[model samples]
Target: MASREFLKILSSARLGDVSAQQKLADAYLTGAYKTPIQPANALIWLEKSYFSITNQALEGASSGSTQISELIAQTANIPLAETFGSPAFGFGWNSFWGLAQSSIESDSRSAAQWQLVNLLINPINQDIQKQLSEWIKKNATSLEKVSDLDLGALQKLAKQFLNELSESNSSFATNAKELLIKLQPKNEALSSLWKVWQEDQNEEALTQAAELGLTAAKLILGLRLAQLDGNTETKSNASLKKAAYWLELAAKDGDRDAWYALGEIYRRPQFSGYNAAESDRCFDRAADLGHAQAQLRKGASLWRKREKTEEKIRGLQASYWVWQAHQQGIAEAKELLNKILDSCPDPKKNDWYELAQFAEQALNHHAEHKLDEDWLLLSHRIIIANQFNFSKAELLLCEVGQLQHEHCVAVDIRWELPKILPRLIQIESIQQRRALLAAGKVFAAADLEIEGNLRQRRYRFDQVTSWLVTTFFKDQTESAIN
Candidate 1:
């Protein structure tokens, strides 16, 4: 019969049925349950039943089998496939005893067997070493067998068990460390594991390990202590000093994160009085160590400092660093780069085009860091530069103050004020008049008559004469002097 039917036998055994319990144990040991059934799970279930049977036998009561099915299932760790039908049931009392013999070693076997069982079952128990020592003394033969089993798997199992125990019991961690040291004397893994245990926020573990020169433990313990001394007004300097000591050691060990933390400390207004120069150096060092976020921060510091400097080259240098950071994919670096490039002038037309193309490629490459504001401003500049009247007006405004209304004629107003003025005047089509006004040359009476007609509301004959005397008088005076 398949082993599943053995569950029923186990149930019957639990009700003080000795025959059923023996039959179930026989089914598991002889592989009569099914083909390809695992012996490990079979042994576990049989062993539990054997213990119950032994307990009953000792008590002189009906050896009712213990319902250890739940414990068996919990330890199985693997899945079982369904059996199609029950196999032929063979009745044999001798077969049950033989199956039981293979799994349950005699008290005479070897010491290794006892140690193996103890290690597997009670690996995390606090008294494991003592219990193992006792088992070795009582069952030397069992221990011999245990030494023959796989050592690697046993060590892994022990570590796993100890890890679980360490979660709730600090003493277990100490014991586990001792065992690991005995097993792998020169290995660093044990030390590293202990370090993790110490850093765990458990107060007991942290204090104990921090005293043992565990750097990470020391750092975390210091931070926790600082947090407890909350009233910074009373203990501010002391707290910073403590934090700084651990942080300096960690930073000296090439911990880039430690450098960044130190930078934050020095940069804090309350702690370091905002020492920008010192903070910048720290951030720069961290950035050099391939700290991506630190690169961004360093670039920002330079950009801010550049804003307060009078040197134009300083502004460009700031933009250079920001671009360097942007190349490293910092989002804020692109914003800073845009602001710098917006106000800076290009020395050549080709350079200006290249700058525009660079902005376009930046938008293409890093869509998240697109220089939208700078692009829009440059685009507007290009559009205004293309218009003749607006360009002339801009140049003229740079040279002269705001144009007076009456000085519209004879003043050589090369300044194209069309962009500044409302659309009421159409200066684009009057190319000749615009040229004449720009050259500081007087136009013929007929041309003036046309202008008077075109802008009659603002330029009447009397007003036109007054504009000539006031606005063009400078030119007249210059001509007389020449």
Candidate 2:
């Protein structure tokens, strides 16, 4: 059973309320809201909340302006109050809660960016301070946005909070080891690390960056280390070990490129972590996440000589993934999908396939002649299939849904429905026959009105009905043949 409160908050979160999302994450984290504590579910909510808040902050940065008067004037046409309270704009709660247009001034909204920033800085739930600190500790990519804070005081405060919440692998601790680095990135390693690496082509700067859990630096360092070849066994062994360590850190964070790198690395039997099983697993993970080339490789991996049953199953799986990659515009995937589909058994034996063939033929004939007898065949077949309890007959009807309204009630009554209604009345149930006859009479009246012949045909309903019965159903076998 699920908690109603948790379900309610989850709905609000899904509706894109940033605060609701954070609260749901908190609920999953603490388990105090009668929801079970699940770290994976909590991380999902936390990710949603963080991205929502960050996007809102970026929007604020782009849209906020110092010219507050123009922004306010843009909304002057709106009659609604800024806030709602009793005796609006009066003393007590109303004084602070509600304000009319005349009460507002440009000076009051001068620091719009600061106001948006303050929302994240001091959220409704104060516990987010600790939650955010721990979150950034693990997902270090968030450092880019945090580092974008322009105010020196806010930057200093953020560093202080992260520093207090730091752990052994913490990015804050690594960057804060020196005051200059924490305050300014370029000068933070001005003297030795950056100069040693940039000017000298040494790997020291990369090592420093990787240690701070920066994903790009880790990838570069891993690649460089993987390329190392030493004259002695001691250094050669050390190089691969360092490469594996750095790459593994990035891969664990669900970096697709890092996982692909590991797959390439393990494909070489000489590498430290080289294992056929691990290499295949890495490729499978990347492919499952929509990597185009990885999808090709994953499909190819399963496409091999095997037992017939096993091969058939793997072939279907490979075709599915390859088809998805093709839809994503991977040319290689498209070529592979065509080959796989061609090699598979024919699909025309499916029951729906037969129905579709009939539909296609009927549609082509109808396309050539607006009110073809073939349209009668198409409609009767669908109506007959539905009577026989064909599960997909309704779906096929929907596929040709446009034809239903293509003819006006006038056309449906005269040359159209009269050609088929006799057989329908004979085969359909009593209730359905009555409904069809009643609808047919109404349509005949409408058809006469549409042709400006209503007064001429007003008393001809019984004559038309009697004619249909005598002409079509007068001979049962003739009606069936038509």
TM values, all candidates: 0.28, 0.34
Report model 1's TM-score to 2 decimal places. 0.28
Clashing pairs in 2: none
The segments of candidate 1 whose C-alpha lies over 4 angstroms from its true place after superposition are 1-195, 203-238, 268-277, 307-312, 324-329, 341-482
Q: How do the residues 1-482 of candidate 2 rate in per-residue lDDT, one tens digit apiece?
A: 77555688999999888667766866765563467765445555555654565576677744333222332332222211211121221121111112121234332222222222222243332454344344434445423323333334443553444343222243223222222222334445544565566577666676886676666567667766776323243344346667777877866644556667677777777776678888888888677655677877877666553234453123555656666667678888756665555321232433444444344333335444353332333333333333323233232222121112110111112232234221101122432232233333333434222222333232332333343345334454475789
- Where's the lowest-lDDT run of ten residues in candidate 2? 403-412
RMSD of 2: 22.0
**Residue 282 alpha-carbon offset, candidate 2, angstroms:** 1.4
Query: Per-residue CA lDDT of candidate 1, range 1-482, in tens?
Result: 43444466768966756456545544554444342454344444445555665676678765243333232322222111111011210111112212212354332111222222234444354354444344434444433213323445554554554444333333233334334333333236437556557466355665555455455555555554444324354443346556656666655544555566667667666664457677767787677655777877766767678658775234444554565677778887767666654321222332234333333333334345443442322322222222222332332222211211221211123333433422111122233233323222222212322332223413332342343345445654787999
Report RMSD (Å) for each prediction in the order shown. Answer: 33.8, 22.0
lDDT of 2 at 217: 62
